[model samples]
Target: MFRRDAGLMAAYLVDAETGELLDDLTDHRREFDLELAHTNIAGDLMDLDASVGLPGQLDPIDLADSLLVRYENLWAELTRSDVFDPEDQYLIEKRIGRLNELGFDVEEMEITTVDNGKQVKMVPRVVEHWHHKRRLASLTGLQVQENQARRLLNSLNRYRIILSEQEGRDVPLPVAAYRWISEVFNPSVQIIPHDLKGGLDDAELFHEILEHRWYLSEERHQDVGMPYAAQSYVDNVLRQRHH
Candidate 1:
């Protein structure tokens, strides 16, 4: 049996004769070999790279220690009474934001009403928000980090709203998303000169562009268009960072 924690894989061997479980696979060469073969077969079936000894392999114990530290920090933050409030109208969004800030995602939430007030509890299923990634990929064909996907979605919604107002009609979501990808996102990122990009990916570069745009707009006391913003970011921010 194989268990995965924080991207580290651990295999448990079962004795064929006694039906006893062995915690360490390294001691038993036959069991280790069998398990490795099974893992390769599974990876092949799932269309994933099955190559052994890939880079960035972390010790499971070290991963667990780091995770424990994170969990402790999260617990400390959540224990504060001001962290969450039942009366807050935007409680759900705030809760999700807090979790996202700590590299966690809520898969399910439970709310209970008591004599004093309501209690909100979130069930964490994974470290990052895979659902957001999947949703964004399906809609925009962009695979990005959870926070990056959320930011891009927000930008897409804003674009859709503006388009709807300009056309004097409601623009469908899929159509708006496609247009945003082709017209806004793609063009903006494409204008970023290769030298100015540093080592950041497209999604990350776009996000930084958006942030730069907001800063420029605030500083200038006017809304500078996306194209101008992208160019300015390339010339100003990315150029400096690359140097």
Candidate 2:
């Protein structure tokens, strides 16, 4: 008969040999211990609820639209055709120039040339502009920046360089440009007041002034200094043209 005799729990089991023996212990697993283990198991089970176990749901329509837009843009960029005439060799450079102006650098291109001894033509197959503005800055030391900005600035700089040579004073190009901007371009525009800023942007206004000055110089058969050009342009043309 089984009975509690020594305040110890005992269980009968087969020993290492083929003989039976009684094992005793002072402490043993209780209902609470089994419940605690089961609680941990339940916590693990709860962690695997539907939200955690399920895959994410996405909007098919949105994803399809996004992919479609991506494909369209890529197709436009890669498939757009560029053509040129036999005499328009400069166009290739202009096309590459325009692309750079738009903040894009064509990395690779091959020019297909058609030669007939009398007629020669070339088409770009690969082209690119790389960190172009930065390179322009590093090399030129003057920063007008961006392709369009560089174009405008360089045009101004070229004229400035010519003006400096005409002056025969060894003045730096930037300084000359600054002088032209202040004396000729800016004051002419500013004279109209802030209410007229809408008629044209600052850059465009300056560009127009430059043109006016150029044609005036040609007409006079001499270099019309900024003072004469600014005064004449402001009174005769700028008021009628725009700010």
Candidate 3:
């Protein structure tokens, strides 16, 4: 049996004497191979695939729900029209970038030349996201998020003069990232323990810690550092509260 949609190709063989199933393939054509004799079947992981949904099936409603959801999303993306003018070329790029940012890689834009090429209509043909994470890892050694890595690199750009001036060193970009991560963000984040911290994410926790540091400094009329801020947060705020 083969399911092209699932990229699954498998062959079933009946054991004549033992009345069992056997796999007879040498090389793999798909990620999984399945063998079944009546109700007996096994795939790579014994996948309960969609072919079970006959009129005599137990859960036909779940299958309909899944198909409805898939169709809904595809219909929304493909059929929905923003429908703008030719003068707004910047909006097209912005729209494309927004879709790409939302984890969709646009394959190509279908631009319609209406009114004999004077007017235009464009629609997205494809979209994909989560592409930047691997690319960022390749460009830089860090395996942080695409957005986080992008922001980190941007923040590092701001710290170029700091690296040159205070320590009197002009480091390379990768080394500078290391220095910034170690000296700035790491120490701040390291002060917070896993148990003491609430549901805040790492980057957000660091950012809030920085904000708390500034707030503590303003309140106490002194330069409260990250560690002190984290300590105070753990003691004064988190301890008193429950979520």
RMSD per model, one decimal: 14.7, 29.1, 16.5
lDDT of 3 by residue, 1-243 (tens): 322312333233334555424465332421132212212332311244454434545344454445446645754664454544433332343444455444344433334345532122234433123344453365445566555544444344434434544454545566766776777677767777787667777666665555566567667655554467777766676667643
TM-score of 2: 0.32
Q: Residue-wise lDDT of candidate 2 within 1-243, one digit each (tens)?
A: 232423432233335555334453122433344445455645554455434652354434444445546655644554355554433333334444454443344433433333521121212232223243453355444343343344444344444434544574545645766665565455655664455445666556554555566677566654565456656766677556563
TM-scores for all candidates?
0.49, 0.32, 0.35
Question: Candidate 2: misplaced stretches above 4 Å?
Answer: 1-185, 241-243
- Highest lDDT among the candidates is held by which one? 1
Those runs of model 1 whose alpha carbons end farther than 4 Å from true positions after fitting are: 1-128
- Which candidate would rank higher by lDDT, 1 or 3? 1
- Candidates in order have lDDT scores of 0.65, 0.47, 0.49
Worst 10 residues of 1 by lDDT: 81-90
Q: For residue 224, give model 2's deviation from the true position in Å.
A: 1.9
